[model samples]
Target: MELTFLVYDVIIQVYAMLIRVSSLFNPKARLWVNGRKGWRQSLKNKVPAGGVDIWMHCASLGEFEQGRPVLEALRSLYPEKCILLTFFSPSGYTVRKDYPIVNHVCYLPLDSRKNARIFLQTIKPKLVIFVKYEFWFHFIREISKQQIPLLLISALFRPGQLFFRSYGKVFKQSLLSYNRIFVQDKNSLDLLKNTGIEECVIAGDTRFDRVLTVMEQSKEIRAIDTFLQGKSAWVAGSTWPPDEQVIRGCSDLISKWIIAPHEIKEDHLLYIEKLFGEKTVRYSILKDAPEKFTDKTILLIDNVGMLSSLYRYGQAAYIGGGFGSGIHNILEAGVYGIPVVFGPKFQKFKEAKDLIYLQGAFSITLENELKDVIVRLGNDLFSKSAGDICAHYVHEHAGATEKIIRFIQEKRFLTN
Candidate 1:
């Protein structure tokens, strides 16, 4: 076991070194390497001596969004404790590095004994919270050794994961280091219980709360209204090339289509413009002249941060990324009381399944199937029924944030 641990440590080091070397050419890798430069000292400067440090670590943007509801609740419930947020990926840190509630946001030091020791000693957090599936052995071991309360929130588990395999004893042992684990479903709870690990609670997914918050705080975009021109539109959000192909096929049936592609590179924008030539107009171009957008039938969203709010303007939505891995946030569209449609690769998502069961969302395998579903949902009566189902489903699944917060208060994990 000791030899196995040493091998794992060396492998982690090698991976980090490779990423650093790749930083010279790869822009994303460069961001990862450059973001960590002098991070330790930067963290030291922000965190004061003897202050009550409450640390939360997330893997990336998705994990950060999942953990946001809990973090915000903690901030409101315990105001005195300084909140320190860390991310393992550059995507998460770069998007939320300037978050107002967090006192400091920095990249997590690589998982090594020396790095862990230095980080734990410098930050000295009373409680450490990991969002989703971040299970760093060295960090967990160090937190256990220092007697700091380590908790994981919004976790999900499956039978096929390595932790359940025959040679996964070490990985299973890592799970024991967490003081408590809050899962998102009963299946995850059962999975943990079957492994003889009983310190877990099914607190539901915090993203339901997150999407509700998004719905409440959504900004009204005037240009979207002009583009709609009182016509019900179909929104295709976080779309990739494959998703674009499907949308292009059935776009003639849908009067107004909002294309919010995942990648907004020049090549992608040009492709979209050519695909719907003379019918498409960029979002940035509509800022000065909102009236000019009324004539255009396709509103191309060539920027980030607007996709979430833009869902509200659509009567039906198609969430992208299903042709690749799983799907993007279906709940983002579902929360706005709209029927959602996606590709065949959505079985992994619990919300997608639930929404489908509720008859609020549909999955299509081909362009013809997409067109059929869209035509069916285009009706006034059918669309209202589906929209109502979505609204009820979103409202029913809220309050996971309160459950986790109540547990923290009962355990008295806060300090002045």
Candidate 2:
């Protein structure tokens, strides 16, 4: 265990050095390096003194979305408490730093013993919450030593994960620091229990709650509506290069397509334009000129923060990223009652599996399979039925945030 901690500490320091080196040329890496430059001092200055401070740590944008509902709910429930949000990734911090709900949003300092001590001591949180799978050993150990209320929400665990492995004893010890863990499924709960840690609840995923909030707040975008123009449109969101190939292969099957590629880099945008040709209009170009897209068959999204609302204009949707590492959010489209399609490598996502079982989503491994699914969903009855199933599945799993809030209330953790 001692040797493991030493090796892990060295690896973390090496990673920090790598990020600093990469920041010289990489724009995103530069943001990451600059973001944490004076985090401790900045946090000290911004965080108010002498109040119940609740801190939430998220890995990135997705985890922030997963934790947003609980954060908002906590704000409403305890108006007097200070809400501190920290992100380990630049993606989350850059996008949500100005998020109105939290008092402050900043990049978390690197996980070292000294950094952890300074962060916790300066922030002096009454309670600490970790979103999804973030388990920083140094932070956890310090917070545990202080006996602060530490909770992990929207957590999921699989049997083959490290915590269940033979050499995971040291890693498993980190789980002991959490006061309570609210997991996503029964399998997660059982997995933790089997490891002899039982302070958990099967409260489902809070992302359902977040997506529900999105559905409520969604508004009409005139240009997007005009682009659709009452036609059955297929919206493909967060598509990688591989996913774009799948879309290109089936382009002939659909007359109207809206694609939002994962990266909006110049090279990527040019590639999409070259593939789709003159018929494709970049979203940045058409937000003010909806009439420009009248002759265009594909409206290529070159911006961010609009994909969720755009799903409302689709008959069916293809969620990207499945062709690579993992699938992006399917619930964003699913909540809008649209049948979703993704690549076959979506087994790790519980919602994808559940949606597949409920007939709300389809996973296609090949280009031909995607074309066939598109054709099948073109039928009005089949489309509506699948759409209904998608929406219903989201609605059914909508109360994890409430359940978590209720648990917090029962524990009397909120300050008066």
Candidate 3:
């Protein structure tokens, strides 16, 4: 066991060194390295010395979204306690560093034994919650050693993950350190149980709850409403170049498109403009002069944080990132009661599989497949039916947040 920990510590140090080297040229890597500078003093200066603090850590923006509902719930329930939200990736912290619900938000320092011990001693967190797949060894060990109540929420596990492998005993021991694990599905629970890890329960997914909340509280985007002008359009969100290429090919079938690319840098935006040609106008420009782009067929979303609300204006939606790692968030669109389309690489997402089986979503590999799906969705009755299914599926899986909060209350994790 000591040998395993030694090797793990070495790997962590090497990884940190690599990031420090990469920071010279890579902007994201630079942000990662810079964010942790003077993290110890930052925590000491910001976090009060005597109050009870609840710490929640997220790996990135996606995991932060999954954990947002619970964070807000805790804030409302325990207004007296201070909340400290930490992010491992700059993508999450940079965007949500000013999130109003939590008392403080900062980057989580690298997981070394000394860093972990100092962090825990500084914050003296009453409870620790890690969202999804974050299982830092030193942090988990320190939390366990301090007898802090640690919970893992909205977690998913697969047969091929390290925890189930032969050489993963050290990683598996980290799982044992969590006091309670709330998973997103039965498969994850089953996988943990098969390995004799019993402190787990199936709590569905809190993302569904989060999306539903977004939909209910969604504000009207006047620009989108003006752009659509009561006409039906398709929303393509977090789209990549490959996804855009497919969408471009199916342009003849769909009349209007609102495309939000994953990377909105100058080069990628220029590429998208070239692909879509003269009929495209950026949302930023269009909003400034809505009358000028009335005839444009493609409205490019050149900003972030609006994709979730944009789905309400479309007859159907296309979620991207499938042609690369996996699909982006389909629930964001599905919650709007719209038929969703994506590429063929969506097997990892349980919501994608469920929606596909229910005919609320479609997976396509080529232009012809997308064209066919779009044509089928053009039928008002069929579109309505599929939309209904998508919305119903999201609604049915909506209570993961409630379940988690109930457990926390019952266990008195927050009580003195």
Candidate 4:
């Protein structure tokens, strides 16, 4: 089984290298994937390195955010230690390559035995933390062999997953290597114990911590502030076409709207612009707009990395991805005291159900019902009630980050 897994890892690595060739056409991307090691290494060692090295790995952008607060919490609690972040996806690594807190941010080389051995030798992290749903057997076993303390942050489990299946002994054994399992919910804890693993605790989600930190950074958000101009704005984040269609149906005469599509390709943006025509304004065209944009009916945020913070400016947020599309994080909007609306399909997300039970969130399967909900929000009483409900939901659900951090600290997992 181990040898077969190693062979599969080599194949995946070769495929990833082939994808790097796409960087030739996109030079900036080429630079990131190709020069990751030497360039990143040179910049990282300038910091003092003799202390404890805590290494955290995540699979992609969502996992990165899920693990971010823990990373920042570690830095604050243990300034003497060096932190290293390993991302298996180029999308996550490239977007976050410049984070100052991470001493080394690079690709988690494919988990072949040879590559895993080399990685363990290179950073030699005293502790390895894997963020939610990113368990690779080869890497887990190899890291465990070094007797490094392993922690799983914001881990979540469902019955349908391999770990719960009848033939899951191999994968279940891989999880046994963890010093502790910090699951996100009671459901996950139930699943883990059913598999005969007991080292589990409920730590909620670290993304809540990350969203709170983003709120702190947005305390003086001048850009989104000007765009909002005291009018009720709808901050649509990480949206797909189904979401856009629903928002368009209701936003024709609304006071203000912000449409940030997931894709920024020329064709995509132009299609979006035509959907609303002159009523829309792109951020790139802000230079040509009058000094003030109080009259701007719709502002299209055409760039990436700014949508989550922009949610702070919204009166009510409609998080895109649902219906047939995968759902985006509605908690980000909910944390800022705004009621979040999304598509009908959200079975995998426990937070969605909790938020709905709290009346902080709403979802619709039908397009026509969306209009009624929007019109209802026009009432001052309904809007205030929704906002207050959402804020209360956020307040009640915080402190997961502290729980996970305390677990790692009490274990004395990270060395100095």
Predicted structure with the largest TM-score when compared to the true one: 3
By descending lDDT, how would the candidates be arranged? 3, 2, 1, 4
lDDT of 4: 0.78
Regions of model 1 farther than 4 Å from truth: none
Residue 131 deviation, candidate 4, in Å? 0.3
- Candidate 3's residue-wise lDDT over 261-375, tens digit each? 9889999999999999998999989997786777999999999889999999889999999899999999999999999999999999999999999999999999999999999
TM-score ranking, best first: 3, 1, 2, 4
- Identify the candidate with maximal lDDT: 3
Residue 309 local lDDT, model 2: 90
Query: Compared with the true structure, what per-residue lDDT tens digits does model 4 show for residues 3-97?
Result: 55656577778876776787769765575466555543543364344433888999878899998888888898888777888787767887887
List, residue by residue over 1-416, the lDDT tens digit for candidate 1.
78867988999989999999999999888989898889778877988877446899999999999899989989887776788999989888888999999888889988989889988888989889999899999899899999898889999998999899998888898888888899998999999999989889988889999999999999988778877888879999999888888989998998899999988999999999988889899999986687977888889998889999999999899999989987899889989999999998998899899989889999988999998998899788999899889888889988889988888877787743
- Candidates' RMSD to native: 1.4, 1.6, 1.2, 3.2
For candidate 2, the 10 contiguous residues with the lowest summed lDDT are 44-53
Residue 79, candidate 3: alpha-carbon lDDT: 88
Residue 415, model 2: Cα distance from true site in angstroms = 1.9
State each model's CA lDDT, in order: 0.89, 0.90, 0.93, 0.78
User: Candidate 3's C-alpha lDDT?
Assistant: 0.93
TM per candidate comes to 0.97, 0.96, 0.98, 0.88
Query: Worst lDDT window (10 residues) for model 4?
Result: 43-52
Model 2: how far is 359 from its true place, Å?
2.3
